[model samples]
Target: MFAENKLTDDMAEIEAFLVRERAKVLSEAEWKFRMRGYGYNLRRTNGGVEVARLPQNTVLGTLAL
Candidate 1:
């Protein structure tokens, strides 16, 4: 576990974060690239937040290709 190894604290800050992030218009090509790379679909919600939904059955890992 991360805590056992003291790798990170319970309230550690994330590497890339959004502090009051505003949504920017993304073109079709840009959107597709984002989806393929991270499996996330982004859309503007009524609440003014860029909602990103992850695809199902998608698992993330680090392995050599």
Candidate 2:
């Protein structure tokens, strides 16, 4: 039916939005990791993904150094 089709379309749209948001978060995380001397890890917990910063050794912080 038309309603079912509409529901499917809406779900697809929502999924696309979520994917874009996740990509944005990942891009920002990568930028921080590269530009700043930060390490990160993505973990799945409680049915959601979490971005966590990891501790780094003082001697090997950045790529340039």
Number of the top-ranking candidate, with TM-score as the measure: 1
TM-score, cand. 1 vs. native:
0.29
- Weakest ten-residue segment in model 1 by summed lDDT: 13-22
Model 1, global lDDT: 0.31
Tens digits of lDDT, candidate 1, 1-65:
12222333222221122111112325645643544444333344454324233555222221111
Cα TM-score per model: 0.29, 0.27
Question: Which pairs of residues have clashing backbones in candidate 1?
Answer: none
Q: Backbone clash tally for model 2?
A: 0
Model 2 segments beyond 4 Å from truth?
1-9, 27-65
